[model samples]
Target chain A: MKGITVRSPARAAELFHALADPTRLEILDELKEGECCVCELTDRLQAGQSRLSFHLKVLKGAGMIVDRREGRWMYYSVNAEALAELDDLVDSLKQAKRARRATGCC
Target chain B: MKGITVRSPARAAELFHALADPTRLEILDELKEGECCVCELTDRLQAGQSRLSFHLKVLKGAGMIVDRREGRWMYYSVNAEALAELDDLVDSLKQAKRARRATGCC
Candidate 1:
């Protein structure tokens, strides 16, 4: 298991913000199956190219997904490292919850 | 470890949305230490009472935090079950990433 490296609350908030949208999460779900071309994402998500592109940009900006160019097409896939980082963030929160419970503070 | 029960992307998005704000994350950070009165959170986070209350409502609405009223004071703390559910959500994504990698898909 990777050691949890707690992120600053602001950084965590940024990452969570990126994940907070239904459209972006849908795009991620598509890419999770495998790398997908922009055309495929637009078709599968039933979103306009411009609309999908906007969400893609947000995911890419947050380091949640990575993109590559293949000739005229753009391919995207989930960033494994980002998912690992998210796991760490959750672990840190869980640890905090446990610590709080240990104190038995009301 | 608890088994991962995957949440729909929309549901995941809703939870993440509640966590997307820096102020909400800061409030969670303070509560992670132990349950705190609303007045203490307002003082520690340097947020106006109404503003802090708004964030608290969002957190509570998403089931991320629990609140209790004692006399005239309201107290807040992290919800351990919600953290566990978030852990599961991350686990599902990690599993997807692994599955994608195993397929050797570009």
Candidate 2:
């Protein structure tokens, strides 16, 4: 996975670290529908305001999602570009595995 | 991510958790080359035998890799089927994102 020089293991680790939490993943699932304000997300997820806010911060910090403020409402949505990067990284690993198989490394 | 009902968040969380550590990721990288005994992995990773063993156990627990023993040597390799399942999950998320965009979820 590393010898392919695709990306550093640290970056992959960071991305996975961000994704390790069930709550955070649930938050991402909600955002996948569309951008939504914190209040809406809190209501939909039935999570405490503080708890939802904490998870939102983690997702944002990992660049997995982005936020915008309109008036007093802060809206969040999936950061598609970031997710695409992660997708490509996983694909690279998969492709590498296939290549190894073709080379009879099984 | 979840509304699609393809897989549970807990399962996704478990997979991501297994990938969260840099050392574990490095161990996976080494295994990508093909099956290797723990001693060879330790030398390649330049990690203490016990430490490497610990990470290998974690990876195996998460179903990301499998181990086999021949005589006194234990060998580890990536679980290609499991990794393929992970690949499909990620691809589903990415496709869902694209579909959302097209559906005017932006």
Q: TM-score of B chain for each model?
A: 0.84, 0.83
* Local error of candidate 2 at residue A20 (angstroms): 0.9
Which whole-number lDDT from 0 to 100 does residue A101 have in model 2?
Answer: 40
Candidate 2 per-residue lDDT, tens place, B1-106, comes to 3446337788888888898888988887777777778887777778998999889888998899998888788878889887887886676555454333333221
Model 1: per-residue Cα lDDT over A1-106, one tens digit each: 4323345888899899998998887887777777888888888889999999999999999999999987888889899889987877777776633343443222
Per-residue accuracy of model 2 over A1-106 as CA lDDT, tens digit each: 3456337888888888888888888888777767778887777778999999998898898888899988888889889888887887676555454233433221
Candidate maximizing lDDT:
1
lDDT of 1: 0.80
lDDT tens readout by residue for model 1, B2-80: 3233458778998999889889888877777778888888777789999999999999999999989888888888898
DockQ score of candidate 2? 0.38
Off by over 4 Å in 2: A1-3, A97-106, B1-3, B97-106
Q: Which consecutive 10 residues in model 2 chain A have the weakest lDDT in total?
A: A97-106
